[model samples]
Target: MCNFKLSSSPSSLLVSTTKNHFLISPQPSSSSSMDPQPHDDGLHRWPTPQEALEEIKAIGKISGPTAITGLLMYSRAMISMLFLGYLGELELAGGSLSIGFANITGYSVISGLAMGMEPICGQAYGSKQMRLLGLTLQRTVLLLLSTSVPISFIWLNMKRILLWFGQDQEIAAAAHTFILFSVPDLFFLSLLHPLRIYLRAQGITFPLALCSAGSLLLHVPLNFLLVGYFRLGISGVAMAMVWTNLNLCLLLCLFIYFSGVYRDSWVGPTSDCLGGWSSLLALAIPSCISVCLEWWWYELMIMLCGVLVNPRATIASMGILIQTTSLVYVFPSALSSGVSTRVGNELGAGRPARARKSMIVSLFCAAGLGVAAMLFATAMRHRWGRFFTGDEEILRLTAVALPIAGACELGNCPQTTGCGVLRGSARPRIGANINLGSFYLVGMPVAVVLGFGLQMGFAGLWLGLLAAQASCTVFMLRALTTTDWTLQAERAKQLTAATNNQSSPPYPPFDKQSKAAAAAKVASETFCSGDTARDGCSIEMEPFIIIVKN
Candidate 1:
């Protein structure tokens, strides 16, 4: 009989053994997991220059492809807009209105809801809890698909809803026609959103970029065939959008199948997915609120612009500026996704210090990107509007508004990145509350005061946006700065371990073949390290399991 005792710091791994069985648990390390228990000379120090560079490299690997994917996705929307513009102002206005409605009601909801799985999947991957990752993906997809039903119904009644809101009848009818055709998009996104997060969590982003690029290559051609040659008009535009998404989904499935990325995790749908939704909902609802609040604000600003002194010029300028901010948004959005993955992965692996460092590096990177965006916006202010319109008033107003929008980007980038940090740490409720306060409570009143009360006109409305971004940035940075990484890491472990009440045991049960393989791998890695005590082991922790050597 072999008996062993284990002890370690709160952040360090522990090991115990009994009757020829070894158990390993998470512990702090100096270098990497392979060199656990090295000297801790600078345990809590800020990352060194070299370490910072390495972190930058790691973040770039994730953010680079993520940015490309984002740009490609943005281009799809742009292409659709261009097609609408070509059809005439009525078609463009109606299509744009319908798109805004869809975003607020459909796309945003699905996106935010699906994001609930990010922290879970990312942390699970880091903790080597492969089964939890797959199960979470399935559960999220089920939740999104269920969510799409009501959203589809809302889209079906788009004309009624818009008419009730006092919109022009002809525009409302056209909007309805477009949205009616877009209903299938809701279900397709229900699946695509989860799959993207599923792969993103595992740092498999290059494939996403590749798939998005492929879909985009087909997007223009499809739009041409549908909207132009086929003479389907607005309906055709909607169909092309839906088919493009469906094509992307098919491409992702093919890639996953051919690459066998699902081998380690996917186990097919089970009864487990039917019941364990509480864990997902906890994160999903707040995430939905956070995303929707931000998205709705922009749409709200567009509405507010409708009441300005010169409605045509102000509203048109607002649209162009909105597009400008959105374009600048691509980089920070990618950075946010990257940092979320980094922080979640590090914490899941029980490396609190590394997680903190990742957050720091991400913030710095966001700041730099923000500066660059600001400068570019300022320099291109005079030229950007020409690409959209030649209307002297709209162009004049756009040039005046571009600089302010640039300033907004300066704050927006960091706050956006900070939101990702919060999400990665499973604190989206905090981000939601902060957004509510900053946008509604703080920003909205100022916009009303300046734009209406003080009569600053369009610029005043933008100033309100600046105020919101500033407050959001401050609060977001405060939240990130005060995070407790160790506690977050512990929480990650618990989250991945506890799937649901009716689910299988805390740790996924392994089959005989897998058990043998895991045991062999553990033995090869740990026993050969010369780091195990005579009766104990220094093996890395699995979320929960116990194995006996043969």
Candidate 2:
């Protein structure tokens, strides 16, 4: 057995440099898998304040484009509410309710599962395990498409389900009409979302921003032509978005496959893609839970509003409030994605201190964005709703809800960023538990009590949101404070370097078959010297080197 260390503290392969060629065997990290052995070189220790600031600057470089991408995504989600609200109170209320339902049953699950790809791809890219990114993408695409089949049934029967949930019959009918044209949205998202994680992990975000902005710019005119002139009603609204998303997806694929920007990440579909089903599912299920719990809860608040007295006014108010908060939320969420990628990449490279510094910087960024959003909401509370509707009651109710939503952001932003830290660190189970406890165990009961028992209506539901966000923030902070960054870095190393939960020897014996021999031949390859900072380091028999990421 050969003892191979993963950290780049040494410049060359662990084996004797003088040897021309040799078969190398590597073992699992250690018997105590959860504890990382501390090194005295200071590479993995806590950072100084200046170092933290520098790390933040690096994270912001990536997050700037990421933030723009998120803003565009928010704009896409807002089309229904913004356009439909202008149609009539009935359309706004009905459209908002249906969109909320679609999110819960369809988009949330798909998006959550896509998050599993974050750690996988981020770690893969960081460690130079370029092949795994393709496998992760293929496996995720398979899972999402399979999952979408059952979710399609829910969208089909949405009208009846809303009626069973005690929604007003007219609102339910209008909601049904909107959902009827939304089926394609589910299928398109299943593909596009996983691709997002793959690209973000490789730090390829600007194209995403460009693609989304172009789609958004085209959508406005399409909305006008279809809904404004053709008078296609809600179906027109649904078609406008559906076609736009489809075009965006196609453009991204063409850019990736043809533009050479992502050439190394994707190698056409392979046999290995079909083999990692169970391993991928292990991370994916928890990731789905972690993200879906938070996303569904936010959407659930809108649904809860529909059952209250003066349902139209309350639902419309919640609609404006939900879209407004979502638009504001794009900032923190974008930072979260950036940090997840940065932390995972550093950890995969076995740089614990960098990952730790990334987390601290993200928390501070979230804090700053939260303050700006709160002030903006406070200033615009009376007028922002004018963009969505002319009704004074809806505008007033929306205004009443803005302050609370803004306050909620103060806590919500940090927790959201913290969740990203968890994802990048391959610790989604912790996030899932925190979300389950905060949103369902504590916050749901509080919401019901305030909303129904006390007749607080929209205000009561927001108070519940605040409670949940606060609880989540406290729990996530506690988790972050206790995290062993060294251990997380070690885990990242293991994930990117290991195969099937075990480290693969550099020269695993190959069968005599032509395919196996060809694979081994390809494996014995190299690029630039195995420098820690350069991505060229990879598996090779000539000056054989291996690197890992978190």
Candidate 3:
């Protein structure tokens, strides 16, 4: 009879077989583990063509489906809006107000706070700290659920708040009604955000795309059933919106159960998740602010338009242009999420060069996408407005603003992707500072001057955005250029190291003398193999870890 033994660590696994008194242990390839890539020439040198191509493929695999998934999710909101339109003008107006309010207060906050999990989950998976992934997910879900409570109270008082702000009584009451029905969405989103990040961190994307697409396909029919057939009115529209997120969450849960893809990382909920709030909140607050600062800027623009010379036309045209930018934003946003995962993974794996390469490749891709967006907006300028309206004044204003908005995209895409790089590097606070400085300090001043002081009107408001994007791009590029990939890799190691220590080791820790001996042996082997000159194979490499069984 033969005996078998198995052992694993972050980097590799050992499988042993024995017959009689003989034993053979085989190890997996280094490339398949957390081992650094062979090249350790540092981050300055450009990646070889093969490396660049591989990085592109990796990023594309995540970004392609991610882009589709984003569009599908965005379409859910569009469908809701369309159904509201079908209900009549009053319902449309009220629903639009409520949706916008929810976005600013509820959805944006949820999305931003959830981003705090990205770097942690990505790095945890990369470093093979599988338990940390589950812990992070659970902690994030708990955090978001807690956050939703206060937001719920805010939603509960929506009418009084809207009325206090001097909004029309009828519209405020309508908005309150719509918002009241949407409270359930806050809880659903709490679960959905962490779940998506948990999967995406592990290079799981197709399922997200698949699930989102399936949900969106059902969204329209569900809307019809509730609003048209049940005649639930605006309440039906709100409920349909809530139900879409709930459906997506359920689908994702079912998919995970059926596929068992989460088995490796998911240790199931545990008491370990109860702590670790501060670490997550540190990242989450800045991420939330960074996202909100950008989102609220556009909303601020809308408010500014309302006070313009021709309020109706300006606000209408602004709405159309905002929609145009939203459409253009989808690709860059996807690229951002993809790069964040890639960077975090490489860094966590202690492959600084590979992480740097991911950043470079993603930046170039974002630039290309930005240029394409600019050209598209420019090319479609004459006719793009017709999709939303045929009023000559609004159309003309939209046509003029479209190209400027496109120019903004030229800067927007790269900056957005750069933000992702920052997130992956666990430096969201830096991105937040940049946004706060650029948009509010620089862009806002420029807008006020151009729009009112110089009397450039609506176009001036867009030019302000152009100024903001340009400044933001400059700063983002500077940040990316100045990044210390080696330092980031060290940080990633530290971040996951704590969690690994908290976990039960598969085997006992090595004694001091044994660890020193093992280190010496590994160093000698690496040096003799002509890897001594490389940064990774030096004596200061990671401590040797192993598991053995008799």
Candidate 4:
């Protein structure tokens, strides 16, 4: 309901960021050598403070709801762990290990894969390519289902894998049990992630937050029955997750079916989806690499803690500590998703400078929120662990790690938001390159040496994570600063128009009359004489599609 339309008033259109820059997209001249006709305005300029505030509100309107949705989802995981903590140290430790494995291998993978939708769906909605949205969703679902097969195999074999890695045998067995039951949640997430992106791109986040909240509210009681009453322990926690995810997925699907606001995009599934598969795959693969690299680094750090001195206390404490970081992280992640939607939409709408403005606002917001998270976590370090467990040792360990988690978040918030900017600009590969360098090339070596070689243990691992985040932040800042805004705007227009050329109607207002005018206008134009053609001109082709299309 907080959704703010970009042009709040007719006067605002000129006073603020107007859609004017894109009003007269030149019809491509039929000549093969024709160049895109230049417009009076090449790109939008930065908005005034009042205009920036309105657009920032537009971003936050999406962010506020998605942030709540993320919080609900985060709470579901933390509650399950909180319940496990109450059960005993063994269940907590086992649940922690199983969760780490599932996140690194399953949820993170699916999440990263789903990010492929941000650009496609966001740009489609921005460009008003309504039909492309539904087709993109179909293609995404197909790809996610295909990827889940191998991940499922790995989850089913997690116990053996953990044991092979010399994990505590009992913890390994319990972790395996938890992951086995959690496999169904993986498929649900595949559907959920795509839906989340599609809806957010349209600035429809209230329903998603509503649905997730209801299910997450139900999740608490379900966890109570499974873990507290049935005594299913960590496996029971996994069952609760499956149900919670299914509830959210089903509700969003139902909304899309009945709301009719998004119905224009859904013409039912079709083979037309196959056409976009390669493009989606191209975006998806890099997105997965970028996101998973960062997600896996942290989860791996937790797994490494399993081999440290007093493994049970360290792992159990991390189970809670990781949840804490995840809780605070939702704010930045939501900002990233929010800005991705805004930027992609703007780019799709052929407003590159508008996208640039949104990115700047998001970075400032992330920085302020990150600083707040740091201070809160630091202030609560000594007392915060009591919220999860009564074990004095677990509490002590968690307290020591909380400060480090807090500091890591400062770098992480902006880096995460920066990735969103890259995704919206259709440059996921840059993020992948940066992540590969920061986490794997630099962060991992530091973590390994400090955690084991230097015998610094848990603190050393946190330091490693901190260093990786800082490195990533530096790269993202450079990417943001160095990008060419005008070129990106041109690319945005081409991609949007190109997509509409293949898929008709809802993607563009170039309906019958507009089409007739465009065709007739081009049909009236002519190539220069053959002698003049030598200067730089070509004959028009039939149907009159401008070859040098803008």
Task: Kindly report which residue pairs in candidate 2 clash with one another.
Answer: 344-550, 347-550, 348-548, 348-549, 348-550, 349-549
Give residue 429's lDDT in candidate 1 (0 to 100): 71
Q: Which lDDT tens digits does candidate 3 get at residues 335-443?
A: 8988899888887777888788889888888889989999999999999888888899999889888899999988899999988998887777778877887899999
Which regions in candidate 3 have their CA more than 4 angstroms from the true location?
1-39, 499-550
lDDT, candidate 4, 385-469, per-residue tens: 9987799989888888789888888888888888888888766767888888888888899988998999989888888888888
TM-score of each: 0.85, 0.79, 0.85, 0.80
RMSD of 1: 12.9
Q: Let me know the TM-score candidate 2 reaches against the reference structure.
A: 0.79
Give candidate 2's whole-model lDDT: 0.71
* Candidate 4, superposed: residue stretches over 4 Å from native: 1-47, 86-88, 227-234, 307-310, 389-400, 449-455, 497-550
lDDT of 2 by residue, 1-550 (tens): 0000001112112343443212111111222222133343334455566667666655665677777877776777677557886678788768877877887788878888878777877777777777787778877888898898999888999999989978899999988988888888888988899887887787666667778898888888988998999998877888888888888898788767655545555657766666545445656777788777877787777668868988879977886787787777777887888888888877776667667778887888888888888899888999999987899989888888888888888888898888888888776767787888888998899999999999888889988988888888888888787766766665566555542222233433333454344433323321111212223322221111222321
- Comparison by lDDT, 2 against 3, better one: 3
Query: Candidate 4, TM-score vs. the true structure?
Result: 0.80
Go through the candidates in order and give each one's C-alpha lDDT.
0.77, 0.71, 0.77, 0.72
Q: Which lDDT tens digits does candidate 1 get at residues 1-550? A: 0000001122211223321112122221225522132124223567778878877876777787788888888899999999988888888999999999999998889988988888888788788777888888899988999999988999998899999999999899889999999999999998999898888787777777889999999999999999899989988888999999999999998877766667667867679777556667767887898899989999999999999988988988998888877777888888888888888887778877778888888888888988988898899989999998899999888888888888888898888888888778766777788888889999999999999999998989889999999998987777676665655666676666656335423334456676666455433322212222222211122221223333
